[model samples]
Target: MRKLLKILSREWFLAGMLLAVAIASAAPNLGRSGGLLHIDELSDWGIFTIFFLHGIGLSTEKLKQGFSRWPVHLIVQTFTFVLFPLLFIALDALIGRHLPPDLRLGFCYLCVLPSTVSSSVAMTSIARGNVAAAIFNATLSTLLGVVATPLLVRLLLGSSGAGISLGATMLNIATMLLLPFVIGQLLRPVFGKWFAHFKSTTNAIDRGVILLLVFGAFSNSVADGLWTRHGPGLIAMTLIGATVILAIVLGLTRTAAKLCGFSPEDEIATVFCGSKKTLASGVPMAKLLFGAHPALGVIVLPIMFYHQIQLFVCSILAQRYAARS
Candidate 1:
């Protein structure tokens, strides 16, 4: 009990909780006559609410300091937006032919999403690295994901003849991404001070919102019978894929940072922040890009797996970095 309590107090545990919520949400709908809480509406609101809190908690001055180190910022941004997608494309060319088309497309989509805000910042901070840099990169990445993710999908996935609905995707982005971001920016002035003061309370709000989103998405999956589409082999394949990808990205970022002669602080920030993808970004994008099809639950399977794996791995990495520092 004591060990479990200690483990649960970690940031990765919070992320695992979010994943459990997502899995639980889908589990109920797997049964034909299940009576589950259909919390899709709540999830929608939760996303926006989480974004609102994120915006309010942001310190623009801190972000600016991070960005002022322009070379480091550029490296992280390029890794996130450019290099990562290219790697996914190469992977597609190599082995994607053997995978399900939807899964391949989902892999591509996951590659192009943004770095996470909270965990990235937390991990970098724990590593005694550039917390401000993590904050800036993550926030900017999420903001840019509104446009970049859609455009990337249209470019890469569209080339494979599974053309994404650009107009619909944009519209969803406007509603989900822009609307909340704008609201958050507008309300930042009013609640920013309070948000700063009650950081722990606001963190709780973030977790709660994410939990609701997980439940809602999973519940939809259960209702739609997403589980039967998978077999034992596919599950094993997914775990392997996730593990390999996480290892590659983490190693790539670290190697690149070391080659560039980054300070330990900046290297820690670069490696951790650059290697992550945001589930918060992925879930909404899944709904936006693939909402027309019921089968997308299966498509998002890789991303869900990757999300939890990254969190668990990075949590351990962050602690190691902290201990070393």
Candidate 2:
């Protein structure tokens, strides 16, 4: 009983995520944009706060030391930007014609995204990996994502549908996400230490923003008959697809690290950072990029599904790596 309770307690956030989905599915009218809760307005402000908090949480000086670790960085970044996208591109070629358009684009978005900062670093620490390098690559991946994600989306999905304006989306991303991040960094001199003091509070706020976004996205989808349109099969396929992608990436990262003669610690960091995608960044970007495009929920599903899948798998891997260490 105690062991079961402990497991449940640890996964309460995941439970909350499931609860949010259920609520959104049942009461779609409440959380949908321009609905009773005014989620669209709240989400705009919430998006700003999320990026501002990211800026405050990050310290430039701390990541400088990892600059010397170029080989590891090369492998990690290549896997993130290059290899991941190629896999999805090939998948799109093979099965994309059969998949729903929004869902297919979701996979492309998933491929181009940067990794999760908090989870990647945390998992690396748990796995007894090189924490400094993990922190560096994760941060770099996100910052670069502002440009990389958009460019890759245009490259992959330009005429493929979704009517996205690449130029305008870039401006919105800058004005919405990047600009606030810059402002936050400037203020970080004073606010950084203060935020560091209440890390748990800030972390909660981040998760809170995610829940609100998730609720809003799923709510909009439900109102539009997302489930009625596709049914349960799509969700099942998303879970299976997310699991397969994570497993393949995890295996390849570990193998590549070994081939390059990396230490066991480096391999741990490589696999965890290389395999994961960022819900934190992906959610906001989707909101910015898709914008009430009808398929908003469908577009975010891959990362949403991938995010939880990676967390579950990485936790076990982290434990195993810790044991070996």
lDDT tens per residue, model 2, 216-236: 999999899998999888998
TM-score of each: 0.86, 0.95
RMSD (Cα, Å) for all candidates, in order, is: 3.3, 1.8
Q: Which stretches of candidate 1 lie over 4 Å from their true place?
A: 1-38, 159-163
Clashes in model 1: which pairs? 25-218, 25-219, 26-218, 26-219, 29-222, 29-223, 30-222
lDDT of 1: 0.75
TM-score of 1: 0.86
Q: Write the per-residue lDDT of candidate 1 for residues 221-263, one digit (tens) a residue.
A: 5556555665566667777877888899899999999999999
> Poorest 10 consecutive residues of model 1 by lDDT?
29-38
